[model samples]
Target: MKKIVIPFTIIALLAACAAQPTAESTESTEPTYEAHKQASWLLGRWENKSDQGNLSEVWEKKNDSIYIGASYFEIGGDTVFSESIELIEKEGVLNYVVTIADAGQGPTAFKLTKSSDSELVFENPKHDFPQKITYNHKGDSVIAVISGKQQGKPHQETFAMKKVN
Candidate 1:
């Protein structure tokens, strides 16, 4: 009887150990937004100075799914252009929205068309000039490219910016 009881107790102990939960097993299975994770890398201040204008872009993460940024373009010490920007994850899709202070229209939104570890592209074919925009991050610098058809002709602008903060 003692031998049989010992064997049964050992079996019960093994079963209890098997039933215990593990750290990985208890982890949530909910899906995480990959775009938000990718966008987190853009948070910081970037600036560029050139003969045409001095441009600066500052980005900050507002929350888990939203990033806010602002861009300023100054020519000859005068503010030529400024815009408020937002990167939002809505319904699992990423949108880059720009609200130009002088555009005299509603915010323009560009949808994410392509993205990688160090690059992102947004496009809005229905918008006027600059229907496509791209940002390529390399080390401590970023190259911003905006291109599209303007006046029935192709036009593109590129800015090489370095991280300032």
Candidate 2:
């Protein structure tokens, strides 16, 4: 009777272990293509002319898993500020990467925290400034908002741009 009971207990433990979910089964199975599709609407050229300067952003789909973009601010036909951007999907996670031209620093990566058909939010809490970035797309316009702590104080900036092409 003791031997029979021990065998039954071992069998029960083995069954319980088999029933538990594995990490691979629990992780997201979403494909990179599907993730990129969610952001396909951002493709095209966007421009904003303000008293401050003329800002332009252009995006292009590089492949099924990547989108390339660039933004620049021009004053009197000279580019004053510019940055290169890459939206990539890897391992079912989306990342927004930006490199400021001539900043003498490597690119910064922001992970996608919220996403919808018309709005996307990326955040990097460890970043010094603009820890949160959001893009809201309307019919023919897009509004980009960046907010975070600047110099130990809260700060935010908004850019309203219209699709030009």
lDDT agreement of model 2 with the native:
0.93
List model 1 lDDT by residue over 1-165, tens digit each.
998999999999999999999999999966577897987778999999988899999999998788999999999999999999999998789999999998898999999999998999999999988999999998889999999999999999998999998
The C-alpha TM-scores of every prediction are 0.79, 0.81
Against the correct fold, how does model 1 do in TM-score? Answer: 0.79
Off by over 4 Å in 1: 1-31
Candidate 2 runs further than 4 Å off: 1-32
Q: Name the weakest run of 10 consecutive residues (lDDT summed) in model 2.
A: 29-38
CA lDDT of every candidate: 0.92, 0.93
Candidate 1 C-alpha error for residue 72, in Å: 0.6
| Candidate 1 accuracy as lDDT | 0.92
lDDT of 2 by residue, 1-165 (tens): 999999999999999999999998999975647667888889999999998899999999888889999999999999999999999898878899999999999999999999999998999999998899999999999999999999999999999999998
Name the candidate that leads on lDDT: 2
Q: How many backbone clashes does candidate 1 have?
A: 0
